[model samples]
Target: MKILIAIGSKDFSKPTLKLGMKVAQAFNAKTTIIDVGEKISEFSSQLVELAQDQLESWDFDAPGVDVLEWAFNYLSQNKLIDTKQTETGFPKNRLIDDGEGRKMVYLSGTACEDVNLILRNGDIIAELREEVQFGEYDVTILGKSRKRNMSHDLLQYINSSLLIVNDYEDQKFDKILLPLDYKDGMLKVAKYAIRVALALNVGIDIFTVFDKDKSQKKGSNYFSKIIKFIRRSGVQYSHEEKQGEIVEQIIKKADKNKIIVMKASDMSPIKRFLKGSIPLSVMNECDVPILIVK
Candidate 1:
């Protein structure tokens, strides 16, 4: 498998690269380091020179030479190279395009580029997954913003075939959570959950949560469907049924390094607010990373 590290304008991307390398080593995958940025500036000659030295030291051949030339050209154009200052469009377009069929995109900022998106670093750490995109790879690892209290600067690492880390160590996920709602969409989500279960040598605890007395019969049917999903994944797992709030129950089961895989559902405004946004809720309360697959 090939993992691409979106080594863009974020300087903190080094940690992500380290983590990604670790993941590649574990999954026996290849790492493709990529970067997209505006031209470098003449005023930052020292920085540019430093980068040139790096390229030379690595003896980075043809493709690397082309990349450095592009950086120099961007600097000549007097354009900003940072992802944060851009107002043109999604700063992640390049990254996301590279992410096609990729495990996950390691986003650096708390909230994504668009929307009122905000993420707690701890929550993001908890939600990391090593499998995504129909069991193709693990989750994408991103760094946090260097802003305000946003700079947690914790040496946390999320595991994937494309692992990114700050130091040398094996951080494997040992437990996983699979929450299914039996929606047709969930079928794909189940495959991702099962893939991680097997890859990390982790035990998967699958659960279904629903409104109390709302659909006991339907819930049973859903549980059966999820079982089939797990069986198809060819992994050993435990199954359970819970009657309670969906987010709360899922959060209760998550731990650091525990990946929770769930289908992305369209939610109403009130529901989003009440649940406090499923992704946000889990990110905030779960103390683990929650992987939401669409």
Candidate 2:
């Protein structure tokens, strides 16, 4: 598999690059480190100058050659030596074109972060995926703040586009959580989850929850519908129906490594209320990745 880490001048560049390096090393995936020429702020520029000054003042000889050799060695050691410096006067457009066969594009900020808006690699890549029907990438990994849960709109967009990786590196998924309501949207998500599990060769623990105060008859009907959906898929899976708060029960069973795949009808409103935001909450509370299906 090939992974492309879209690098630009931002606070997120280094950390995102580090994370990408770790994953690429683990998966033996080919990586391309492309630096999209974007302007840097005055403060950052000053910092760069100060660092350069210190380097010049040092007793070390051939500092420039050392730096280049270090970067080359790092990339070579990890089999990620493919480096492309974009100076096409259109970074984002060129990035989308370069991402033709990439497995994923690790993005930072949204459209507001870009000046031209057209050069926003994240949005442009998304537009490319929508317009061009080349299923080159399976997921676009976006880093979320460890401080709080990500916004609902972000989560929703993430769910539909590709697999979103937050802070789940510490927890590798052993089992997957597929929560369904048996609606068409939920069924679609269920199918997506099945494909992911198959790709990862992992077992899925499918489950559903209903209002705790609902009548037993209604609960039974919901359970029957859920079971019917799973059986209809003919995919190897196990399921359970429990009565409790939707998010609470879902979290209770989740370990550090187990992923929860749930369907949300309204990703925007859920982002605000943090209700019906099972995936977001899971990404926040658990150190596991939440795969949201549309």
Candidate 3:
């Protein structure tokens, strides 16, 4: 698996980085930590290389380099990076511009498959979308944003599963709340929940919320298959069924203590764009971390 983690600042991104690395380690994923700096003007962009060389000579780092340096320190302190790589410290001078609007430095990882720190400058969503396409990442992890339409744009445009870390407390969460349906992609959602449950040493709450406007059936064969798969994975889990507005029920049940895992909407892109979807509503309403699997 390959994971992309987007971070903005040192002050607010610790929880995101902390949780993102944990998830990457859970899957043993090749991980990239990306910092999207403010976009430079055309003139500044042309002179960026010269500025970087001058900054390094003056014992100063270029824009976004400090964030990468901090990330490297966090990995080294946590023993996530290989000891040999940590000994030399953050390789600020080795950050290479690949001529693709990305500057990156690679490191060996101890807990994950590998680690790479990347710097880019552009609109956050645009840079992230391009990186996801270029890397073919399995998941993109980032902190919740207060910017309007941030969540909607990410869920709609990014071509990978997403984990939005909101109010993450490592010791506070106790279970993975997996909202299920008789949908076709539920098995994959269950698998993601199982991996996270094992990673956090938490149990699973397999919840099925029934829309009052739709069928009121108890469960289906597909739901049964999901339960069986969770059981076989050896993760402790409990199941429940409730009838109500799907989004409201999920937020009420979550109550800020569980990590939510659910499938992305299967509606056509146009319909989803116009009418929105269940997972998107939940993401906006809930305060807990959520993984929307695509």
Q: In candidate 1, what are the lDDT values of residues 141-186, reduced to their tens digit?
A: 4433333122111122223322222222236456668887656666
Question: Residue 169, candidate 3: how far off, in angstroms?
Answer: 1.1
Once model 3 is optimally superposed onto the true structure by TM-score, how far is the C-alpha of residue 244 displaced, in angstroms?
A: 0.6
The lowest-lDDT stretch of 10 consecutive residues in candidate 1 is: 112-121
Could you report the Cα RMSD, in angstroms, for every candidate shown? 13.9, 10.2, 1.4
Q: All candidates' TM-scores?
A: 0.48, 0.52, 0.96
Looking at model 1, residue 174 earns an lDDT score of 63
Stretches of model 2 off by over 4 angstroms after superposition: 1-139, 156-159, 166-171, 216-235, 267-276
lDDT (10s digit) by residue, model 2, range 1-294: 434333443444444444445544433444444332334466686686577458656743212223223333444444443323212221222223244322222222221111111122224334333322332433333444444633444554332333445444423666778876544446566666665555455678887776588743333465466557666755567877788786777877766666677765554654446454566665566555565544
Alpha-carbon deviation at 51 in model 1, angstroms: 12
Instruction: List candidate 1 stretches off by more than 4 Å.
Output: 1-31, 34-139, 143-172, 212-217, 220-223, 267-276
The best candidate by lDDT is 3
Q: lDDT of each prediction vs. the true structure? A: 0.46, 0.48, 0.92
Q: How much is 123 displaced in model 2, in angstroms?
A: 11
> Candidates 1 and 3: which is better by lDDT?
3
Which 10 consecutive residues of model 2 have the lowest summed lDDT?
109-118
Global local distance difference test of model 1: 0.46
